[model samples]
Target: MAQWLAAQPKTIVVQPTTLCPMDCTYCYLLERHLKQEMTPQVASAVADGIGPSWEPVEVVWHGGEPLAVGLTRFVELLQPFESLRQARRVRHKVQTGGGRPITDAWCDVFEQYEIGVGVSIDGPRELNHHRVDRGGRPMFDRTIAGIETLKRRCIPFTVLAVVSQDGTGQAAQVLDFMRDLGTSWVGFNIEAKEGANSDGQTPSIDHARQFWRDTFEWCRRNNDVTVREVSNLLGFLGLTQERRDADSQHDPIPTIAWNGDVVLLSPELLGVRSVTYDDFVAGNVLEDDLSAIVQRSDELLYVQEFTNALETCKQTCEFFSFCQGAHAGDRFFEHGTFAVTETDHCRNSVQAPVLALAELLQAKGSR
Candidate 1:
């Protein structure tokens, strides 16, 4: 238990609020409309809970929409980490949908705190039609305007684009759009069937393979922009000669919700409920010590099952070393159990890209 608790994650994700302005079609946030904000007391509790560490800790501010808390309230939320930041390195990050109103005041906070911003957008206007508001109005222009503001303020940000079936064929166009937006780095997230919205079919593995291949070619042509998925796949395959240590399946990444409830692993698991696992809450940080909660988390039935399933994958699956098994939230949502192995998510996200890139590299080598 001591060895298990020692492997703490470097990043901790905090959900400051659960109030999003837009209602995307495939959003997994079940309680997005709850309109709850994390109190400064809870924020301070969470910060103190983390305590001191040798390495720099990153607090990722994520939510239904983190910006929904407004600039003034958001600063109050960050106040708890000030002591830690002064003592040692404590990096701040915020992940937002980027469709909300972006004011100079918000930019001032970003610049002052040096927060790493990650904005969610699905590419061109046509591709982003699914990420609309409650009135079904397209948010492409609004999101772009917010991104443009970030650019004007000289605050560097990364773009997170969800690749749906509609936009899979337009990889080049998507690359061009992000490039024109002056985005230095872009991450691609497949439209996953998780949480409340499980209507859409997972993209076929073949289609995903082709999409990644095409996107890889585009990235090769434009050396200025970095595509995260391609780079990660290449690194995993040893094609880029940048191999790193495989992520530990048991490492605890504490994701604290707005109410101070701590969820290990995926932050998406915060609001989701399961019949067997209940709310998947290890314990409330406000009540229990963070380290104690993380240590006790290993005793959770679902966590035990999740760890067992990962061990099985490591023993059986060929790609185990690369992915270290699929994410716990993905496995639970797609398979309805953490003890299951191999999901549509694994096929498209993990296997397809590696196979596609391997084939491409093999052909080039043969030539």
Candidate 2:
């Protein structure tokens, strides 16, 4: 058990800049860029805080649009961390919106330093309307061009698509677009109903549920490519035979924002407001000791509350153990508590999937 724990390395997320050019409706970070550039001193401090101990650290550059910092300044920020990566202490990654053009020089930096890259795009032309520029013009062409550049250069990347009401009805079309893009893997993230655009345009929970069902069935029928949303579901379906103990190395998945704040579990948690903390950031890795902050974060208090809710759920819901409670941000946004489950997630992410699977089983039995 101890050996298993030792094998996993800690992950560090570094946000070099948060200046974003695009103005997506659902982007919570749109209001977060009051100030969004990191100094050399802060970047160096981040490098020193993580230190040489955490054997396999992953530094993820996430931002309003990570590449908005420009390729030159980005290189300056990465130079210090790149040296550490070369020494076998850390891994690197960058997440971008792909709304901007990519340069050969940028690709060279990515090829030289990171293990993988992730881009945000809904799908082909028609499905990506909501992610437009400030002038209300569709930027899908530019995004597609950026993706083509990556594919042309053989740079390994993943596409993250937000499944919305429109997307739900057009899962097949979205999948077709992905297949054409030659996307090796795709993550179909559900649009959160509580953030920037939630007030006027949140998708119905029923629509979300249908979308998950349709998307999952699509993945099962077309098994040639990797679909991350279905992969997670399959794990829940007991389809995978592999089993291991809990002592396995559990690296802290860090999501560092442009201002140096660290969020746990997922990067999506950043800017997600909580009732108690009102802010999701546990600490700034550059200014605070990473280990100490992780230990003392107010974020954990919310996690504990959520865990307590799960315990209560197990007593009531038959599928409690198999379910993922609402994402912390969603819970806080909808219910005003991290401990409670949002009706949307319960209906969409959990209840809907379970019921759909049950119906399929019953129909098969009757036949």
Candidate 3:
């Protein structure tokens, strides 16, 4: 079997805790309510696993509401990685729900660390109804208040909006709302079936295509906030096909869960398990070196299958430039394995955006 792409981690998605305050419909974490916070020892062990690598690493303190770990523990969690930060070996980022409180204290720490913040907010109140509290109450106002706090403190942030059926129709409106909310960049994630959040309702490819087209048109008119999808495709369009293919190398994006368990490739695959592949833990940080896990990532049974699938995508798919192999989680969740490609996710998020961007750019050039 062909080996997976050369494995060096570009991003380490650290799940500091599984304790999220708000429950979002699109979220896939099975144990979001569990208070399985990462220990300082585990965090240190993770840092130690890297062993003073000079290559810049992005340490993303990812989901299950990283802020819900409480301010003190949250600060304590960063203690181990201080050396990496000081050495400029790693840059820190946090993707928060923004459903919890974002006080001056949070902003203070963010400023001190110079962390890049990305808030999970789906535009305004109407677009944000999917993310609610445990009691099923809408968290739009609360989330907005937290974002407002960040703005007041002069802390810059990016917004990640999940495009639901409603969002697919109102792309311009959603983009406008997020821009008005003062986000530096707006990233739109398509609602997909993954983990425990599958309710069978997902946006159709036709509708999703429309959303991308509208987003591209809106971006042409208003060049204020960068629409991540549009920007990505635009960059890809600028690149020669040879360069694009060469740049499609899939790095092992290791997601270290609260308990030191590592899931590679797809961060959304952390809590998910497959009978064919077993639990997708490449290795545990406490038991194995991070490099060792990454080295063996290409040899993993599922990864070997992914190698085949990605080969197919590279050969057969027209829009492989946009998403590489799309996402393994989407393949496993939607079609039950990563041994094949052409998932609904690829069509909606990858192909649609690429097609829309190409057509729009061509029209602009002609004009």
**Candidate 1's C-alpha lDDT?**
0.82
Q: How many backbone clashes are present in model 2? A: 0
Q: Ten consecutive residues with minimal summed lDDT in candidate 1?
A: 240-249
Ranking of all candidate structures by their lDDT, best first: 3, 1, 2
TM match of model 2 to true structure: 0.84
lDDT of 3 by residue, 1-367 (tens): 3244655777889999988888887788988878888888888888887745527889999868999888898888898888888888888999999757999999999989878898988876887778999999999888888999999998999988888887798998888887898886988889888887777467998899889989989988898899888888788779887887673567678899999999987888887776888899899999998888887787688788788898898788777656778787888888888888988788888988877767777988999
Better of 2 and 3 by TM-score: 3
At residue 212, candidate 2 shows an lDDT of 65
61-120 in candidate 1: lDDT tens per residue? 998899998888899999988888776667899998974777788999888887899999
Q: How far is candidate 3 from the true structure (C-alpha RMSD, Å)?
A: 1.8
Task: Write down the lDDT of every candidate, Cα atoms only.
Answer: 0.82, 0.67, 0.84
Residue-level error in angstroms, candidate 3, position 309: 0.6
TM per candidate comes to: 0.94, 0.84, 0.95
The candidate maximizing lDDT is 3
User: Tens digits of per-residue lDDT for model 2 on 250-365?
Assistant: 24466667667777644556666746765667788667966666555433766556555645655566655455343555665566665665456566666666666666668679
Ranked candidates (TM-score, high to low): 3, 1, 2
